[model samples]
Target chain A: MPLPTLAESAIIVGAEADDWRAAVRLAGRALFESGATLPGYSDEMIRMIDEHGPYVVIAPGLALAHARPGPDVLADGLAVVTLATPVVFGHPHNDPVSVVLGLAIKSAETHLETVAELANVFNDSSAISRLTTAASVAEIQEILGNAS
Target chain B: MKIVAICGSGIGSSGILKVNAERVLKRLELEADVTAAHLSSLSSDAADAQVILTSAEFVDAIGPTNADVIVIENYFDTEELARKLEAALG
Candidate 1:
């Protein structure tokens, strides 16, 4: 499960603003509007974020938000967003997040391997840059393909 | 060693906690079979586990866990958690 396999270019965006909540909402919009999500996904995602405060900030600017798959996951896939400017989600040590990775797994088990792959991906400096600057979906896919 | 991670649902945060716990145990050079399950099924699961790791909310979620419950605020802090688990198991 490479990042691009789960990441779609259509969802990527460049941000110039500073509000992190808006950034999350921006990512949420991509998830919802792209028809990449199941019904009620946007609300569930917002609720989960409001409660958890970006629980999966794997590194400084990288955050992965995943909610339980009840009625939110339209497919057995994922939706992603790369922030144009970094925004803070109120994490204790790390303040700003530049890339928001939203995942909707149809089943709890479907994401295990992807999560493991993400763990390794988040550890690299160069790889994160490639993903952060990825301008198109094919480029994003290429990043994942080259990550190995 | 058999380890059981009990949480509200068998699949959400508890599942991530289970993954971190396994990573910690592995780092500590301990061999253990780990499983994450909902609080509702604790009795059967607790019967075989050598160690039980859970959050502070155990009191409300499933009454009191019968095994040595290691209360942790966040499961992702592997270093502190590994140390806590080592002490509990020791």
Candidate 2:
């Protein structure tokens, strides 16, 4: 199945998250509320960051918060939260992320497929800035073209 | 040569890095096998790889590796990938 779009993926715009963990939690909240994942998924996402450093901060202003495939992930889905105030993940360069994208995949195979498809959305250098300022889920969908 | 893209979890944007690396390699007129892998399994997944592409934050975690570890700041930036790949493997 294709990844959920902004409508079903629980895209939260201009959300309030004071810290990186809170930011990931906001995204995870979206995923949970969307019926895409279990409640403990957010804590897992945070733990990944804690154990592996802030490597999830994939881009200058983006954080692809995720954990390995597990029972916590109800389905292959995604969630996004735009922080009202950007949070830092302690990465030297990609710190102060504005967008926290929660990704839950059932398997590594589909995981690859999802990211390959998402490559188009992220390829646009301005995607981060646009997503950061998008007013609503519709605007987010617009910014993230080829939304499924 | 084989290249492995490392991320916190293999089942995430490492796929993006893997695909984008293929695109960059093709544009540079180079060739290699690329795979997405989790950082924790660096020993097995990257055992026979010649190059390892990953984010800066994961570099130190990689510890010691025979392969050339390249830091990619932006997995979506093909231009940066092209430049870095050219500089390293040109």
Candidate 3:
């Protein structure tokens, strides 16, 4: 199935989050509102972060926050949040994340194929660069349209 | 084989590591089950992982684990680092 766009995922921005943690919280909220998260979703996601760091920095500006497909999801869906300014997750290769993609899957198996496909799309620099500069939901959606 | 790719956040750089490892593993004809995890969460899952892969900065976190730890740059380019991982696994 086709997933949501960056704008659809980016429900919170600089105005909402003072830092990356707050931004992740905001993204978590968006995911919850979209019916993607169950109870203890944030805790599991936070656990992943606490254990790992911000591991999903795809490019200079993009970060995809994901966890194991166990506790964080109420349903199977994906959420995205874009930052007005980059936020750091402390990953050495790229920090200051501008885009965050929240993924929640009902089962670990269901997520593998989609995540592998998403990884391929995210690997494209041109698509990532356009997403980084997009200023509005529509623009971001348009970028995803091209990328997807 | 089940391969666990680890990184600091398990978000940014590890994603690349996962992709690159998948590519190399594919080429090597290794039927692999690869997943990416943050270094913090690595402990619980490390017992069954055939190989533990990550980047240079976070290498210390692997600490005495049974899995062999291989560190590379965060980006997807694999020529140099892939060789290192291949050697270690052998």
Task: Find the candidate with the highest lDDT and give its number.
Answer: 2
TM-scores, all candidates, are: 0.65, 0.95, 0.71
True contacts kept of each: 0.02, 0.80, 0.15
TM-score of chain B alone in model 1: 0.86
Ranked candidates, highest DockQ first: 2, 3, 1
- Against the true structure, candidate 3 has what lDDT? 0.64
Residues A44-142, candidate 1: write the lDDT tens digits.
Answer: 766665754454454556665656667666764445677777788766654577777666656766655554455444434566667788887666656
* Candidate number with the higher TM-score (1 or 2): 2
TM-score of 3: 0.71
Model 2's lDDT to the true fold?
0.85
Best by TM-score: 2
> Which pairs in model 2 have colliding backbones?
none
Give me the runs in candidate 1 sitting further than 4 Å from their true place: A1-4, A7-10, A16-18, A33-35, A123-126, A133-136, A146-148, B1-24, B35-90
Quick one: ranking by lDDT, best first?
2, 3, 1
- Ten-residue stretch with the least lDDT total in model 1 chain A: A1-10
DockQ, all candidates in order: 0.18, 0.79, 0.27
CA error at residue A13 for candidate 1, angstroms: 3.5
**Once model 3 is optimally superposed onto the true structure by TM-score, how far is the C-alpha of residue B4 displaced, in angstroms?**
3.3
